[model samples]
Target: MSSHEKHDVETSSGHDIAPATSTASNGLALKPTALERERAEQLARLPDPDAGKSPEERAEIDRKLMWKVDLWLIPWLSLLYLLSFLDRTNIGNARLAGMENDLHMFGTDYNLSLTIFFISYALFEPLTNTLLKRLTPRIFFTGIIVAWGIIMTLMGLCHNFAGLLAARFFLGIAEAGLFPGVNYYLSCWYKGSELGARSAIFFSAAALAGSFGGLLAAAISKMDKIGGVAGWQWIFIIEGLATVFVGLFCWWMVFDWPETARFLSEDDKIRLQRRIIQDRQGHAATDFDKKYIYEALKDWKTYGYMVIYMGCLCPLYAFSLFLPTIIAAIGYSGTTAQLLTVPPYAVAALATVTVGFIADRTRWRGYCNIAVVLVGIVGFSMLLGSGDPHVQYAGTFLGAFGIYPTISNSLSWASNNIEGSLKRAVAIGMIVGWGNLNGVVSSNIYISTQKPRYLTGHGVVLAYQVLFLLGGTIFMHFALKAENKKRLSGARDNMNDGLTDEQKLVRGDNRPDFIYTT
Candidate 1:
């Protein structure tokens, strides 16, 4: 194969994407020719209606394309995430449905169990993501989902503390790669401008799962007479079956990577794929090196990012895993509690979509992060301040809405700031890994004493929101400062120096140039 042909992926019509070439002797790839580099850059910077793919004249074309892509991506993803999240979170619903009594968990044992899952999940996330380079993300991804799905179903069968812990630990292991892998894959398909909204659209599945889980539990609790199985058991069996089925289906549906997708036509592949690398102002990085990961760690921005993301697990877990219990305290039965839980997630899903679209249109991410966090604080504080069911329930919307930015902003920020090819790969992994470390802390916040009113739980969650908002500010501040630093550093210094972004893969991170979009 010619140099460019080596990188080529084919479309359905057997059309080939433009080939990329590398000059490096090392395993790392160097950028292609200057002209090829330029083409990649142009593609990246193309204004949305990006490249007029869906021009004003072709509204139907746009709709059809969106549907075609979403058809495969959305259902499978929604099902995948719904299952994982529902299983992880059903503990909350199950808690209210009588898990605490049957399991003999008291004080904070349940909360501790929830927190433990994240510990294993956070610790292994980076390791699993790096594995993607070697693993067929499709196979690798599906394997984990299927394993976890079975584990979730088995949670219903647990008779004691040990059994529950064993299930959660394996559940953590199987579900580890999911969030980061999908985030990385999405980055491959969509440009920075289009990603935020699409990301939200994808993530909203979790919220929907949250909504439906409540309803499922409500109905299941009514089936309390089935073989003496608790309502929580039904929650597990149903969601787990759905997860396993959807996971099997996802392998057939999801695009493995841009280069490997089965759907796009060759011309569309050529046109679509070529656009990203070229969009870089100039230069590309090639080489798969440990150094990229190191530099990202060295970069203080990683620390700043950790703030918003790291502290997130508490609020999210508290909301997802403990929500049913929390809502149940508002003086409702399991069914009504489940039904009420739906609104918060339903509202959250809507906000996720709306904010993503607006953020995409404006090309502003930090502002959106800040705005969402602020609204979330309102929701969290309401829970802290009131005991009235009406008031506390209303706060759920704000809380759910606040989290819309977790995926949208985090991944978008990484895509904007990360420059080199290997660096982009590694940086995104760390972003997810380090940030999720907070899940451990987030999980343990809900204890038995905190229940009914959960004064401590509410306080801790509110405090987490406060921390995340501060983290958001720091992220924007550092992002702006980095851009300023780059500006003062003066013009970039190589043939690849002025290369297009797509060409970046060839640049082998020698600290190749990148602009941090504030």
Candidate 2:
């Protein structure tokens, strides 16, 4: 027998099955890809712990392990994220508490402050996510949290626009890592199908932060004259100090990667790793590689997801930053406005988690995205078409519920479709980075001049929702479906016929066996 035939015989006998390669049309033997070789070695080194267990036994074990992971992992991450979001968006509440007047911020200084935060935020996200792999989640997360918390506290001391700008810029840099970093971090622990709900549970903290921030701001604003601090100053100082406390505590609470987690047993670690590997179709390398970064940059789908994220984030930031102001415009002011912001966000938090659960169970993230964006569109239209304050206030509830859920859905969709650690990290970072760059647009569009109806702001947000509906959710649904169909048809089976293993792994999501989640 020829060498190719001998290799095939070895594969059939399960001796060297890792490289699972096909012959060229010309009958030439193809070399096993690097990923295949690595996967084989990993499988040998860490055989599945559940391999000998019956299906019912494995199911029970998996259920228990998932609960353990959820109990240990999700709540801590959610708390960190909540504090991060509270620090970042509390500026909106501070504005209501007289930040603009106290700082003598002119026509666009307030907008500029918000815009500058996002500029640094957008620029640093990819960098921070890259560091997350190298530095480990514990160090990276805790360090950034401490840094941002300190900065947030100091923001309360800013006596001028320049001072506030500097604080916001640094705060942006410090807080930038948490959102995308957590997204990537969660991807490390959960399967694609499980990510939606997990991410939603994590992201619900933001909605909760909005709710809590409002109540906190309303309560804290009453401390306006205490210790010679303004209400806005108290808001920043109090919230910032609370964040610092959480950050210090996180040092003890945060776990590293699954294999290194202290809460899991040796068998649990093996089983968890095995399940994650199988979920990715066995692309399980965790080591950092330059090629993964390059591959992420080269993938068109990364940009596509970024566009979808843009649709979600633009309006998201706009609404979050301006919700208080919008409520004030709707015949409520000061504490009343702050308090009113609570219900919409509370409702949104509930809706976000609900949608996340549905997406996970249905495995239909794209469809869920469409459904939420439609709801947002209806809400935005009500705000635009009606002059009635009651109708407009009702719009906020719908807007919050609709927009908040899309992030988790779209993020899980992106995570589901992408394979590999570094590649997924970079892709998520870029998607979030580019998406958040729109905060500049979101900030400026809701100009003070466009108050009350703020037709331009409402119109722009509505347009973004439409784009999300048509260009993002609907387009990606069909596109991913077509890609999965092509893969199923086996047209791509020979695409890697002559490629090296490293090359095949670099192909990432384009690999023949990789099926996209639509």
- Cα-based lDDT for every prediction: 0.68, 0.82
lDDT of 2 at 433: 90
**lDDT (C-alpha) at residue 140 in model 1:** 76
lDDT of 1: 0.68
Candidate 1 stretches with Cα past 4 Å from truth are 1-67, 281-287, 478-482, 485-513
Worst 10 residues of 2 by lDDT: 6-15
Residues 1-518, model 2: lDDT tens digits:
22111111100000112335657779897876555565555457676777778999999999999999999999999999889888889999999999999899889888999999999999998888768766778899989999898999999999999999999999989988999888877766776677788889999999999999999999999999899999999999988998888899877788777777799999998887766544445354335668878888998889889889999999999999999989988889888889999999998999999999998887787889988888899899999999899999999999998899998888888877776666777788899999889999998988887788889899999998897544777888898889878888987789888988667767767787666678
Compute the lDDT of residue 305 as modeled in candidate 2.
90
lDDT of 1 by residue, 166-241 (tens): 8888888888888777766655555556667777787888888898888888887777759978777777777777
Angstrom error of the Cα, residue 93, model 1: value is 0.9
Best by lDDT: 2
